[model samples]
Target chain A: MQKDSQKTKLRPGQLSRPKNLNLFTIRLPINALVSILHRATGCVLFLILPVILLLLQFSLSSAQHYETVIAILHSPFIKLMLLGLAWAFFHHFFAGIRHLAMDVHWMTTLMKARYTSKVVLVLGVLATLVLAVKIWM
Target chain B: MLIELLTKRYPGMRAWLTQRLSALVMAVYSVFAVARFLIVQPNSYEAWVDFFQPLWWRIATLLFWISLCIHAWLGIRDVFKDYVPNPSVRDVLDKLLVVSLWVYLVWATWLLLG
Candidate 1:
């Protein structure tokens, strides 16, 4: 009976990756959305950390070095990167709050969960834009 | 009462509720700090100094540092809690996290205010 029930291992191409991320039917749920954003933001921050460390090392070297760091920050491309960092920071921050709220059972209802997730993304984007404008101007 | 509050009202479910809550608070202040910096772009050293001179800004910056310290503490504490389950070892590590947070807060305050 056990031998008959045993399944054969599949050969290559027996299973393939999905063609696309289907957002309509069988939608990926809100919790999964938040989880993916959290992981992605974490990865982005990890990549950005070395630049921050470099700034720290240079800033501590001397007043002239500090000025050079400030000048680099003032560059257009670097400004854009910082803008991305700002948004990433805020996006991760709000999503973290959403996670906390879920943990505390404040927004655990299905409707509330989905609605709050949307709100978090909207507010995060709004915040990033506002801060970027402020920094860039 | 405190234990009940943490167990029931804490943001995190299994552990690190305090840390998660601290991070949430820090996020709020961070948005404000960025906004404030944008309000006054302070191109010169004197201008930057003047920006920090406002009593309200000083208080807000103080709170911001406090929040950042708490958030860092929570993250580090969670690491210890997850990896070091031995009660005695965990307790020691937890105390160290708390201490480091205070130390960071003090250093930040000194730099910003003193």
Candidate 2:
């Protein structure tokens, strides 16, 4: 009776504090990591929109400005930076499509989900690489 | 009957559908944009302007931006609703975010039309 009464009080156990922050040691499944990366890239795209829009605004504001902006994008360093942005965009995009498929009940199984995630990652990387080659070489 | 009842009674069902529909539009646009970019490689000023000049492309871009705005607002509102404890404060924060997103959307529209 006392034990049951104590449980009714709703006292939970003490909280444990984690000491290590290392990520590499934990081997997360590919699908889990891919879902995480989707959210991460979504945040990146969300946070960077102001800058992207500002650049677009400048480019559209005037022809002279457009030339200058295009010149800036022509630089190797800027191309590399844009390449990273492209990868984030591509990865987020493909992963988002996979999510939509799941929403529509297309591939809700664990194995199928993981397989689609692998496909998303592969397509994103390949597209990014092709864009990089076209821009740089 | 059950499906209709479920769709009508369930909370946040409309928002969930909105997110998916917007995602569909955005996904299609993303693929088309990538292929167009890869083929044309609009690194020059003239090519860049040319890319935006086509009426069909402009309409597609406009639709994509509209979808993006709707998608983002619903997602952000959901996050604020989940995380923020104070109802009034969350309402204010939500309004602020909505205003900011609208500002960007209007700016993009102007860039497209003007």
- Each model's lDDT: 0.69, 0.83
Off by over 4 Å in 2: A1-26, B1-11, B38-43, B79-92
lDDT for A20 (candidate 2): 71
Q: Which candidate is the best by DockQ?
A: 2
Chain B in candidate 1 has what TM-score? Answer: 0.68
Q: Write candidate 2's Cα lDDT for B1-114 as tens digits.
A: 635644757657767878888988998897799789879887667788898899889889989998988988887776677689999999898898889889888988888876
Clashing residue pairs for model 2: none
Prediction 1 global C-alpha lDDT: 0.69
* Backbone collisions counted per model: 0, 0
Cα distance off (Å), candidate 2, residue B73: 1.6
Residue A28 displacement (Å), model 1 = 5.1
Estimate TM-scores for all models. Answer: 0.60, 0.80
Clashes of 2: 0
Please write out the lDDT profile of model 2 over residues A30-122, one tens digit for every residue: 898788787767767776778888898889767899988878989989999898889898898888888888887998898998899899999
- Which residue pairs collide in model 1, if any? none
